[model samples]
Target: MSHFSGIWIPIITPFDGGAIDHGALHGLVRQYVEAGVSGFVALGTTGEPAALNEQEQGAVLDTILSAAAGLPVVAGVGGNHVESVLERISLLNHKPIAGILVAAPYYVRPAQVGIVDYFKAVADQSRVPVILYDIPARTGVHLELDTLLELAGHERIVAVKDCGGSLDKSLSLILDGRLQVLCGEDLDMFGALCAGAHGAISASAHLMPERFVAMAKALEEGRLSTARQLWHSLVPIVHAAFAEPNPGPIKAALSQCGRIRNELRAPMTAASDDLAARWTLILNKVVGSPAGLEQS
Candidate 1:
């Protein structure tokens, strides 16, 4: 199996009123690839897959896969409906995607056995490799380590984006040559690295790809202190992006840098004015000269 290491970005989709903005999406893809990103995760949590219609998901997958060139594209969202999820797997199987990033069912709250069966069913049908997504904080259900180990033994199950936010649980899975764990939390990145994770599926890389890449390299090279310092500098940005709903602070920062417009779908709102202002202040404190900030 091919390796998936380094900084993989969970990209946020750019939308122009319920429709995928191909231009903006393509531009972001090119920009990220140029910025030294190792892989692309289109339609993941950051991409707002829940908000996207099937047609939009297909379109974004096509555009992102084509734009990503040879870099790996992890087409996201296997959705909740088992039938729908299987259908998504079929579609992704035919695409140029390197793997499928499947999050747990939101609001359904299935049992552990159900969770295991859900992935097994999808993996049985999936043509490409499957990267199990375990972001319990978001999905309200955690794919227990035993379930993951069982699924990892499957023929097509390849890797995972471990967002459970538990280093202990993540570590347990990685011990004894289990699944390859890609640290899923932004703030705990350095810690995850210390705990033996392969790499990260980081959302912050959308804003600072090259730097995140450098940190990964630094850690790989045994420059622990250097990597920690770089990781520390990003805490403010991380805190800000998460202070509000995700892509909100990120979109605001992206717009401030001119990557995308500060627009979000309903049920998802923009950052409060006071929060936006705080993000600006935080950016100024860390960014110094808008060096990494995008401008129109």
Candidate 2:
């Protein structure tokens, strides 16, 4: 029943020759839309928002919104500065986004109560729904169980992108039933879904989105045997996608498929030659397999 309940791509911001490749970005969104992704998360971690300036981020989101053709888009808003984050949320409120994904303040490592206050403030400011992004690995501040439960009381804070890396905590959130849980860790997608997570925001799904959508649908429909087969088949590609610090291997695979150029910004390089080769071989096997070709 939740609109967030399915495979959502935290889309990569494609680049070509040191510029934001709007054409490639548009094409990627169209490709995933056709692939039956539930929606997209523009400017999320995968999109490299930290590398782009305000103008570039806005342009990228505009292109994705246009290409989405009415599919829901959740814009990513993150920062340690409360006022700045709220300002970003206010700006996004004018856009046609389904929600905002707000991560905990990074580098500051605020206390749990501070985390609660921050999200509460963000939820209060956001006109659109808010999906809490609980990626402690990146933020260095974990959204402890009690903090999350407290935040769930906010009407606007509708869901969580669960990347806390604690299965017990993730399961607890699902069992609580107040906030919809979307698996943010690609490798745990299956287990999370089996535990009743609403869906996933997968980076690897950029490669075989339809397959991911199918797996989610199968699980939702109670087709356990089919979902198991799909998950088993996807494990290798998932591993390959995250093999080299995100977006690199993902960009390489997309480039190999002729979707986008294998380019990344400064500080984030392209996938290594060896990793690219391995990715090609793995992609070939997966895409060529009957499971990959099967329609949902």
Return the top candidate by lDDT: 2
Candidate 2: tens digits of C-alpha lDDT, residues 1-296: 23688999999998888899999899889888999999999999999999999999999999999999889999999998999999998899899899999999999999998999999999999899999999989999999999999998898998999999999999899999999999999999999999999999999998778888899999999999999999999999899999988889888888877777888997998999999889767876888732343321
Estimate TM-scores for all models. Answer: 0.94, 0.96
- Each candidate's lDDT (Cα)? 0.81, 0.90
Point out where model 2 deviates above 4 Å. 289-296
Q: Mark the 10 consecutive residues where model 1 has the least summed lDDT.
A: 287-296
Give a tens-digit lDDT track for model 1, residues 44-108. Answer: 88888878778877888888888887899988865578898787787777787888888888778
| Candidate 1: segments with Cα more than 4 A from true spot | none
Q: How high a TM-score does candidate 1 get?
A: 0.94
Please report the candidate that would top TM-score against the real structure: 2
How much does candidate 2 score in TM-score? Answer: 0.96
